[model samples]
Target chain A: MSDLKNLRGKAACVGAATTGCGEAPGRNSTELMAEAVIHALADANIPLHEVDGVFAATAVHSMAAMSLAEYLGVHPKYSSGSNIGGSSFLAHALDAAMALEAGLIDVAVIAYGSNQRTAGGFKSISEPMPFEAQYEPRNPITAYALATSRYMHDFGATRDQIAEVAVAARAWAGLNPEAFTRDPLTVEEVLAARMISDPLGKLDCCLVTDGAAAVVMTRAERAKDGPQKPVYLLGAAMAHDHRMISEMPDLTATSAADGGPRAFAMAGYGPNDMDTVQLYDAFTINTILFLEDLGFCAKGEGKDFVGGGRIAPGGALPVNTNGGGLSCVHPGMYGLFVMIEAIRQARGTCGDRQVDGAKLCLAHGNGGVLSSQVTTIWGTEETL
Target chain B: MSGYFDGPGPEAEFRQFLADGKFMIQRSKGSGIHVFHPRVMVPCSGETDLEWVEASGEGTVYAATCTRRRPEKGGDYNVSLIDLAEGPRMMARVVGIEPDQVMVGMKVRARIDDLNGAPAILFEPA
Candidate 1:
């Protein structure tokens, strides 16, 4: 779509920053967005007046991009608030890149902020699913538990293997001061946590914390004028199979299969070439499911691939080095933070959690019960 | 499309049928493919030639989970995705057994039951 190969390295993310995460008392989402946008623009050494495009998606505002621009007092020529789920930010990044490459906008700022933890967490605003509403399943968690059950039934993935994901994320979180939870997590502790749904415990779910993140993008030439080294957009792709989990053709698989291949093809790279990975880990099963679907391992091999401390800190393959949503700040929409962490790692700015010699990194975002999957490949100037 | 526009919507019709003690689903008249969560068009073929047909009321559990709730809050219940013998999957609860005992691959049969004071389709071991 839209000649992904031609768009390779045409636009780059010059600045990435996050506002104070975990707990921001008495602050609204718009304030968080404004602060993050200001910080990110300062990181890029660009004035707010130079931002001609705004992109954002949030649960608080229906017209999130417009609200962000108005709050920040900028007149934008281009904007999008398309909410496809948590992966909306990565999708917005692709949209911004297209607009920048087309000369429609010279500077684009994509951001998201949520105070879900300060407010009530996880509201029930789902439209009636007439055909399948009677079952009384817990909206998202039960759906994930259902998938975990099927994966276990089909591939013999054990609870311990799934627990390894949480353990590894906690290990990474211990290195990041911004993480919401940094205590050492063990497999037994995860299994012993209160059961929210069958095959999934409280520890299996992601954190509910107030946070905001933003990224600034510009044309390849303009990025060279920025203060920070540009994290080039090598490839980006997004796809979705079903809106509801029951409608999914296969619970163990996700649309990452389609998007991952296309993104890698556009970048002329493969999974093996990546130095680190950042998967949207809303649930423990998600990491395993994505690992398999994204070509990191064969079908049904994700459980074993993450075993024996493979994905943990200082492991063979560093994944979710910023602790991921499980331990990091997950303020409902987490895709922006996922993309930001990958950018930070690729820039070698992550002091304690950075992967050594990480020239190339991959960030994958998921939304709506594995509904939307967007895979974006990023690299430093050396790789380009 | 043919039958849905006659009276109430497809969803209302399905619920009324269930209330009348008949469990039904939609079938694409041309392709014979079944669909669940009643919709306007055949999702795969985009054909509007749809008609109401009684389901077999027999299905196999494709996946299942026991959602835990406190004892004062209705205790625990099982949520299951059942593969109907007619080829459509739907979400329901597996009854007549412990919530945690509803296993994947178990054969189940649908029956009319009460859900939040409304008629619902619940499943039991076949």
Candidate 2:
């Protein structure tokens, strides 16, 4: 294995933005994505001419990289179109960093945009080609609901405990100006929401919206000139389990069980070192499961760990500080937002919602129906 | 207009592949049980070898969840992960009991249930 430390470069996150989820009256996926890319360049204080590579991530929407590059009017040195579910953006960021380190591309831009609300509201494409025909045709909601049920059965976790996750997330969302679902949600409201899949109510599932987010990566040397306090990418890891839910070793554990430790080891840091965490919360149960899998708490102790206001704003280890996929805008690419929030918090760019002296952040992303997972550790110091 | 469950033909032949004992669950290669649909060839390397074994219907419920809303093709059913005594976990619908009675690590046994007149393996509390 090549030492990631040896591949060191001044990797700086130049631009980051997420289109707030809601009805986009007249925008398609490509149009939304183009606008996001332009905004990201402006945010980074970089010119389009400086960008030499483009990495695009999306689940449902399809726009070729070359076509998008043509639309954006910037011919790049290298380009890639990655489709690895929601985690693709974060994985793309790491890929950009590695490519920059390898001298394949100097400046790489990663972007994700989708009109899932309109696409799903009106009849859009069927499940992507890869998952279209499975023995048990896995739908995200149904697959996650099955896992939620298992968690409840194994841990004696009650409906109230699961609702607590939603409640805490919404509380954080209330503080975030960019969050979409800011209405204060209660345990009662969560339990009472319309059921989509048994045990998984409307509150348990993430929202679908037309939105876009982008991130720019440049070598560490170049980054210092852009953002005064650029957050460095210390380490990254990705893992994939059996694609179908049935083939999974256990629904309670995700591929993260394999990915998380490797990422921490590569960065030479432990979970305790992280001052803040941004876990992928497509469903509230996922957050609880991650709490256990990431070693924050022992297995079956997640219910208890989250019950006593621990994961909330003033708790021991504050999580989802910018709200999560549950209460925040879920643009199908929620992981990108996780990375965005982590960067904002680490840089202390977030005004009131920022954690005090947060030096380390853990950003996790989930792809497919818990099929693929990736974890990235970022900090102020170049630990590697 | 294509419906959700619109299949090319009846799934009876696939079910028979399991009942007649012709179906073998190997740890590796072109074998193993069919847990997910649209069977694809699973390659087995030397590290993970193929082993022929019979499935002991008896197992414990690793996890289970109830569904009130389902695609129009499939009605409301309980989806669960059953840990077979033979050492593999499978996903199937749980039947023959009320929702509240379902518990994790609860004893369960495999039984064939009809899905739209097609027989599919299901689990029930023993």
Candidate 3:
């Protein structure tokens, strides 16, 4: 088997794009996805016939790769429809990188779309676990609330500290014109929002929006011919610990703890080397937990590490520069959008929210109830 | 046909046991390792040498959250993960107190309760 560490910088993202988000009244998931795929291909200055690998995962379709391929009118030589929940897109990036490294396919297109917001709110994409379903926890929100309770209990982290994550995400969103909820948000407002579940109010949850995104990738050598500067995939790792939240070994920690080091090691860099970070913040507590698990701080120290605008725009670390799923467009699975934001930041294309001279950045995706984690390191041409 | 393979699956057997007013759990006959959700095989070893046994019904709250509901919609209820004394953790609710009052590390005891006209296991203060 090929070593994952050896796959570093084997593939680079040449093009990325997102369709109109928040509300596409009449557009179906596949329609939105095809639009994104077309736009991303155009951005790469590549035609549809150049894409030989199709990778996708969605809440709407079981055979997402096949569906996306059929919709785009291409017969791909390689395809993957593995769905590990919200992190499915990041997993696709890792899979695509491996395929590109092995010369299995020349060009790969990873795409995703969701109409959950207009389809009448988010539905549980994962099948209900026999044991966990009986308790009637409100799908993912309750699962996350349980984690919040345990995290707060173990570390004495207050609700105010947890609310800071949402506040920071909103602050970032205010700078992104494409963000869904860009109005200024406060910690107190988050605390006082209607309780979805104890310890997590409404503001702690991510926005329910309709959107689609696609990214085109190729071997690092071929990526140079693309229209936009290629963002190289320095390192990538994906992992999962459990399906049901109750079965998760540690509620306060996620699979990121396991994958983060492996990814960083593969890239020959650590958390400190990142100019910015993009995390799939489905809930406020997600930011706190992932920051800690990704080695930004000690296990219980995430609560304090994010306080006083540490992760906000003007803070030491610029996180969720595209506003994140918390305040940005979260159309069910948010993994792809995070990667797109990181890619934009690495390209130094983000206007108001861009991190100064961003070169090396980390984008992490979380799926299920912190079940699946894919940590990817993206860097600019200068880093190579 | 031989009767060696004739029975309800692990899930059905578990629900039937609950209906019989008995709280039960599964264990690996070889290693005595416990598992929850009544799976067919051992999670660690993937061995099929599993057997059921009566549980002590004693557990401790590992984590909890109170799900909010409107007043006419039965108000609120506490959903919790209880670490059973038998070494497996399971998801259930702790009752006999206010929903928000349920705290992590609190002792609890499992009991058979009716939910949606179906028998289920729930927990209460020990």
* Residue-wise C-alpha lDDT for candidate 3, range A1-384, written one tens digit per residue: 756569788899999999968888878899999999999999999999888999999898989999999988898989999999989888899899989888889999999988888888886556778787777888789999999999999999999999999999999999999999999999989989999999899999999999999999999999988789899999989889898988999899898999999999888889999999999999999999999999999999999998999999999999898999999899999999999999999998999998999999999999988899999999988876
Show how many residue pairs clash in every candidate, following the order shown.
0, 8, 0
**Tell me, what's the RMSD of every candidate?**
1.6, 5.6, 1.5
Runs of candidate 3 exceeding 4 Å displacement: B1-6
Candidate 2, residues A144-215, lDDT tens digits: the string is 877888777777888888888888888888889877788988889999998877678989887776778788
Ranking by lDDT: 3, 1, 2
By lDDT, is 2 or 3 better?
Answer: 3
lDDT per residue (tens digit) for residues B2-108 in model 2: 65334432234345645563323434444444332323233333233333444567888876666664458565556676777766676666688875356678899
Residue A335 in candidate 1, Cα distance off native in Å: 0.5
For residue A361, model 3's alpha carbon misses the true position, in angstroms, by: 1.0
DockQ of each: 0.84, 0.35, 0.85
Considering lDDT, which of the candidate structures 1 and 2 is the better prediction for this target?
Answer: 1
What residue pairs are clashing in model 2? A10-A219, A10-A220, A10-A221, A11-A220, A134-B37, A135-B37, A135-B38, B26-B32
Shift in Å, residue B17, candidate 2: 2.0
Interface RMSD after interface superposition, model 3 = 0.8
Candidates in descending DockQ order? 3, 1, 2
